[model samples]
Target: MGSAVNDFAGEFDKQRFQTVDDACKLVLKHFYMAKVDLKAAYRSVRISKKLPFRSKLAPGIFHKLSQAVRRMMSRRGFTIVAYLDDFFICERTKKRCAQALAVLIALLRKLGFCISWSKVTDPCQKIVFLGVEIDSTTLETRLPISKLTDLKSELAEFLLRKHASKKQLQSLAGKLNWASAVVRGGRVFLRRIINGIMRLKQDWHKLRMPGEILQDIKWWHDFMSTFNGKSFFLAKVPITSVVTDACKSGAGGFYHSDWFYVNWVEDYPFATQLHINELEVFSVALAVKRWAQNWRGKRIIVYCDKAATVSCMIQ
Candidate 1:
């Protein structure tokens, strides 16, 4: 009767009813089988005064939602209707269902509520909500592929928006520089795409640190120079790295990454995860552990995803 989009929408996410099966089952055991649907679902109701931001189309959506509720409620035989779009107090008996539905229709009409039978589900079988399929006998909700498709689009939009502003793109650049070796290698090229952010702050520029930039450029050139042959040899050099860290949550952890010197000669350069803090200790322990009469000349590089972590180790 009253048009209010907010009345229905805010509760859309309230898991007050987790799924169709859960809701139906609760009513069945505690109540009854009378069911009704509002026609025009979303357009059946008008926007409430408190939530009248988009009034142009709110009425249509409210009407639709109301129609759906009315259709189902009117036919379910519920004498009383709580929501024009939602049927209330379903009973356990078929006769009760009809009586209840009738009373509800009379109340609505008396209250100047309009009925649109075309929108209601014929007493035929069932309904579905949040992907669950339901009926008088049982309710089965399935994972909706459409929802995932919608989510994918949402994620894409989020990424676009998240990277749209200067601050956002700067954060993204920071994340990418640390997360991707390839991006780190091509930092200069990637800078152009990210740096054109609108309204960028002067002092807060998203530029790579000078020392880091030099290291990245040198590393990139070095790797590219011998990517095919002797670089492979360099990569195969046996490496032993240690990683350690302390967490604010009162947790400490350490890790070791190793590779045979001979395997470094493979086409792919060797790679391993190392915590910058732990690697320093590992370097000392490994050298001491391997202390022998013969000195094995070997070269290896320790890579850490976090620049701060790497700096902490050196300090």
Candidate 2:
């Protein structure tokens, strides 16, 4: 029902969590942040009589309503970062933060919205919003301890099972998707699980968990166990540019004055079987492997002629 109703609503310009991260960067150090939650957010908004469904919340329609709230808040000059019903008010000082929070609460009340007072946080240097902990003092975002522990526990349970129902896999995928907002390169690891979900024919179907899926789960579990989950808000400027290309016989790339090339051996198994797109990706991979050490802790832009390769890498 959601999928069908969402089509009529079209695409939404919803604010991403990354935007919050970026907002944190602008006010790094000694900033106060507080979160305000709207009580029963979607239910608070009235549905139009013109719409077909009137009882439950339609995500698409709700999003449009949320955007109006965001624009109103922006026009009022509140430094707010919002995702749906969650709003994080950012300010340079505790006093200003408190003032903004007070005014926001009053304004929202006047607008016929109820605040979840228990969920509201006072102005502080750090606050948890949308499950991600944002620290203004350190200018970093991370999954809170509770979220990390829960994720690890779930993954551990999956490791003991030989298979999982489609619903179970989908639930886990959603959690991982949320956690990926703070975990670097986390989405890359989710490809296998997402692919598995796509292959399911029914919600009750059981997927025999593959070795690769188990490996990914284990990797996530181990990583979270020790990782602090901190992702800094500092943006790295690209210092190096790489141009890469590939042919049927070989692949080559150059960075600055240095160059590297690899020639496919006569017995190369994929020489005749791989498509040009695959070779293009391989060329970029080779380039990274060749110079990753030098580029460590810095950013680099890669130039690839193949649009397919670029799209694949972006994903």
Q: TM-scores across all candidates?
A: 0.30, 0.78
Evaluate residue 255 in candidate 2 and report its C-alpha lDDT on the 0 to 100 scale: 90
Best by TM-score: 2
List, residue by residue over 1-315, the lDDT tens digit for candidate 2: 324443465455554333455455446578888878999885677767656663223554565665666677778877676667777788888998898898888877888888999999999987877777888777778887887888889988999999999899999998988888788778888889999998885678899999999898888888877888678764446864789998888889999899987777653556557898998998888888889888764557899888999899988
Candidate 2 has an lDDT of: 0.78
Worst 10 residues of 1 by lDDT: 227-236
Report every candidate's CA lDDT: 0.40, 0.78
Q: What TM value does model 1 have? A: 0.30
* Tens-place lDDT digits, model 1, residues 103-129: 665655554555666543323234433
The weakest ten consecutive residues by lDDT in model 2 span: 1-10
The candidate that achieves the highest lDDT relative to the unseen native structure: 2
**Which residue runs does candidate 1 get wrong by more than 4 Å?**
1-22, 29-84, 129-132, 142-148, 156-315
